[model samples]
Each structure stands twice: as C-alpha cells, then as structure tokens.
Target: MCRMARPRKPLLSRDRIVEAASALVDSEGLDAVSTRRLAAELGVSGPSLYNHFRNKDEILDAVADAVSAQIDLSMFDESDPRDWRAALHDWAVSYRAALTEHPHIVPVLARGPGRRPAGLRVADAVFGAMVGAGWPPAQATYIGALMRYFITGSALGSFARGFVDDETAYDPADYPHLGQAHLLAERRRQVDEGAFETGLRALVDGLSVQYELLAPGGTVRPAPKRS
Candidate 1:
C-alpha cells in the first residue's frame, strides 16, 4: 500500500496569502478582507490560512507592508548629490504615487512603521537623507513626520469626490466662486493629481526656506525668552 506522493507545489504560501489579501482590499476595501474570505479565495480550508498568518490583522499588516514595499526610495540614495529640496520633491511624488495606487491600505500604512521591515526602510531612507543633508536630528525627525502626514492625508480621500456632480448642487447664491465645482467629479484624476502636485511643491518650498535658516552646525536657534 504505497501512499500518494505530495504535490510538487504547495497550495498556499505567505506571498500568495498577502497577494490575495491585498487584492481583496484593493477591490473591496480593507474590511472586505478576512481569513475565511481569503481561504475561500485561495481554494483552501479556512483553518489552512492560519499556517501562513496568525490572524486577519496580521494578513492586513502584510498587505500594507507589501504596498509600502512598492514605494520608490531611489531619490533618497546616498550617492545622489541632489540637495534636500530636490530629493524631497522626488520622494514625495513617488510616495504619493504608491499610496494613491493602494489607497485602501493608507490607514494601515499611516500608522507608522511599527515592526514592518519595508515600512521601516521607507522611514529610514527619508530620515537618513534629511540628516545627511545637514538637518539637525530633531529637525530630520520632524521632516519625516511632516512628509508622512502630508502624503497620507493626500491619499486618504479624494477632494474631487467630495463634490456633487449635479450642476445644481453648488447653488449660485450659496457658492458664487464655485460655479464649476460640479465639473470636478468628472475630472477627478486631473483635479486630485494637480492638487497633490501643487501641495507638494508648496510644502517643499516652505521647508527649503526653513532648511536655509538652520544655524551653522545644523541646529535651529532657540526662541528668545520674554523679558
């Protein structure tokens, strides 16, 4: 009585699990992902998912990290001679692109790196680049936090989507300046992308001034005490 040979390829893997979960989140939002749903999607028993992930939160974390892994960090390359302003402009654009693609995962990713390696790498690259450019350590940390807030806030929702498409929605009496507000929904992509770029440029420009004001030795001057 010979036993049947095991299949050459396993039906489930960590990568496979993450891919399925990420797709679910992308298509149906984060709440759509569950261990049972994943098991069904993967053509495996519900309990089998436990072999790869301890719980749905773990799976979601993996999915979020996978999204983080897609972000471009080359702009922050140590070998690049680009100044902090240039590097930040490039990095913020790349960061926004990644989050825009996986908007459903933005909430998870916005929670900071936690223990996720890919997320940590992103934070490290940004902070290291800022510090290497002569920003004080505290300022470098603040820069990282500021960029995260800006990028993640931009990704969290669509400004265009907030407007109603009906031309009557923006009454001429109530919103004289928003005569074309109804058109925004039809041009969601353009409006959103343009807004992101405009904000990014303004943010970097403002930071550039602050960067130049850093005192010699890379520290900011303390505020004067009131007499």
Candidate 2:
C-alpha cells in the first residue's frame, strides 16, 4: 500500500491564531474569544492553539500587540529640530485611527506596554521623540502617559452611541437642551470623529504651551514639594 502524502502548508500558526482571535473580538466583542472558539474558527483542535499560545490571555495579549503594530510611528522621527507638536498631533491621529478600527482591544492596549514588544516600541518612540525635541525626561514620560490616556479614553466608547435614537427619548420637559440628542446615533461617525479631533487639538495646544515654558530663559515653574 502507498503511504499518504503530507500537506504542503501547516494548518495552525501564531499569525493565524492572532488574526482569528482579533477578528473574533472585532466581530463579537472581547468576551467572544476563547480557546475552543478560536480553535474551531481555525479548524484545529483546542490543544493545537496551545502550541502557539500558552493560554487565552496570552492570545489576547498577542492580539492587542498586533493592533499596536498597526499604529504609525513614522511621525516620531530622529531628525534635528524636530517639530514635536506636529509629530504628536499626527501620531495621536494615527493612534486613534488604529484603536477606532479595533475598539474591542482598546482596554488591553490601555493597560500600558507591559511586556508587549510592539507596545514598548510605541512608548519608546513617543518618549524618545519628546526628549529629542527638548522635553525633559520626566516631562517626556508624562507626555507619553497623558497621550495614552487621552487616546485610549477616546477609543473606549462613543458619546453618540449613548443616546437613544427615538425622538421622544430626550423629553423636552426633562432635557430642554437636548432636543436634537435623538439624532446623535444617526450621525455617530461625524460626532465621534469631530469630538476626537476637537480633543486632539485642545490637548496639542495645551502641550505646546507647556513645551514653550521649558524653553531656555522661559519661566519654568517648580513642582510643588510633597508634605
């Protein structure tokens, strides 16, 4: 009897696992991802997933890192006379864009870089760019943290989605100022994008003022001493 020939390509892989898990989260929220479900989606046994990932959390972490890898850090270049403000504005926009595409993973990504390599690279690029642009080490760290908070918060949920689409949901007797609130859901994309842009501009503007204060000969106020 002739022996059977082995298939050319492997059935399971780390990339395929992450891709499936990410897609599951994107389509059915984070809670929808599981070892068994992922295995079924990949057409493999649950034990096979273990070969690529130790556990579900590890798989989630990989998925989050994959999303992080999608972020654009090219704006934070190592060029002289770097325009840190411009770089930050562009970086924040790019960051929001990636998170918007995968809102389900925002919580995991918001947990700081942890041991995720792609997440760490993002932090490194942001901090390095700030320092190279004349921001002190401590301030650079603060800027990185602040931007993360702002971007993650923006991606967590949509303000427009909180409102009911029914015209009578916002009763004028109770909410006189929200007469047009019912329309928010219909214009969600516009409202959310506009809100993000508005907040991004305000944040960058505020940071620009703070950056100028660190200028040579500018008044740099000392931090309050702890009791």
Candidate 3:
C-alpha cells in the first residue's frame, strides 16, 4: 500500500549526452569527459550512451562540431563580396575567439576536419571565400591550414598565457634575456592580444603580398596593413 513512485526523468539523448560531455570538458577539462562520467552526469546507465555514440571518440567529434557552430562566418559576403584580406582577418578573429572559449577542446579539433560536418563547414567557409576571391586552390587550402595552425596553437595556452608574474621566477644574472619575464604576466591580457594581433597582421600581410603575385590584383588590398 505504498504510493506510486514518481515518474522517472526522461532518458538521455545524443544531444543531451553531447551537451553534458561538453560541459564536463568546459568545467573539468577533456579527461573529465568519458562514457562513464557522461552517463553519471546524465543520470543514465553507461550503455545508454552507446545507443547514441559508438564510443567516446564519436561523442567528442560531435562535441567538436558543436564548437564549430559557435564560430562566426559573416566574413564572407553574399551581396557585396568583401576583400579577401578583410574576410581572412574577420575569420582569424572569429576562429580565435571561438577556440579561446573552449581551449580544452582545441587539441581534439586539431586532428583535422575530416568528415565532421560543422568543422568542415568552418573550413569550407574559409577556403571557399578565398577561392572565390581568386586564390589558387592549393594556396587557398594552404592558407586555411595556416590559419588553423595559428588559431589552434594560440589556443593551446602555454607561453601564450605568458610567464609567471613572480619576478623571482627568473634571475637576471642567470637569465638576462628573461629579466623582464614577469612583465609578461604583469600585462597578460595586453601581451596576449598584442601578440595575436601582431602575428595576425604579419600573416595576413605576408599572404596579401604573395596573393598579389599569385592573382595580380586579386582581392584589392586595404591600406597595406591589418585588413
């Protein structure tokens, strides 16, 4: 003569599983996202996750694709095609911002775009915009790869985060070159932003110069600096 048990909550779905897995990555880092952990997070049995994703890799791929969806693709124009320099700069900014938000997932995405739809979409948007702007196929592909390299490397968070703020971390007599290492941490945000912009400007500037030779007036240059 006991009252009926309250109805159980809904079982997990692929989307829910991926979302939970992503949250695990966001909160605890990549190692925290496992089948067992995801199941626990979803309040479901481990086997239920396999019903949606064959394994952790597939689940991660889905999570990565979801991240790609967060990237901004408005750099490419439908009505008034923007110059390729501006498009590339826009792409670099957007890509960096997206990956920076999910640094833990960056390494996984570096495996290559492959058959992941959203990752492919990001790659396609960048490559297609360049091709449409008259970049040679190989060069366009190479440029796409270059941007990925920069963005992913930047996302890795090593020296990119800057050296320790403790001046004692480096002894000037022992390491004269790093005497100002603490300054990096002192101005962490400014340092990181300045480095990124410097690298971006240099990359785009070099590409612009080369593209000029490759397409001789392809994608009109803008002020010979950061486009």
Top model number, lDDT: 1
Candidate 3 residue runs with Cα over 4 Å from true position: 1-7, 160-162, 215-227
- lDDT digits (tens) for residues 58-111 of candidate 2: 999999999899989888867534488888989998999999999999999999
lDDT of 3 by residue, 54-88 (tens): 99999889988888988888877666466889888
For model 1, residues 26-88, the per-residue Cα lDDT tens digits are: 999998998989988988899988987889989989999998898888888878878889999
User: Which regions of candidate 1 deviate over 4 angstroms?
Assistant: 1-10, 222-227
lDDT of model 2 at residue 143? 90
Superior by lDDT: candidate 2 or candidate 3: 2
TM-score of 3: 0.87
Q: Estimate each model's TM-score.
A: 0.92, 0.91, 0.87
Q: Per-prediction RMSD in angstroms?
A: 2.9, 3.8, 5.1
lDDT of 1: 0.90
Query: How many pairs of residues collide in each model?
Result: 0, 0, 0
Alpha carbon deviation, residue 60, candidate 1 (Å): 0.6
lDDT of each: 0.90, 0.90, 0.83
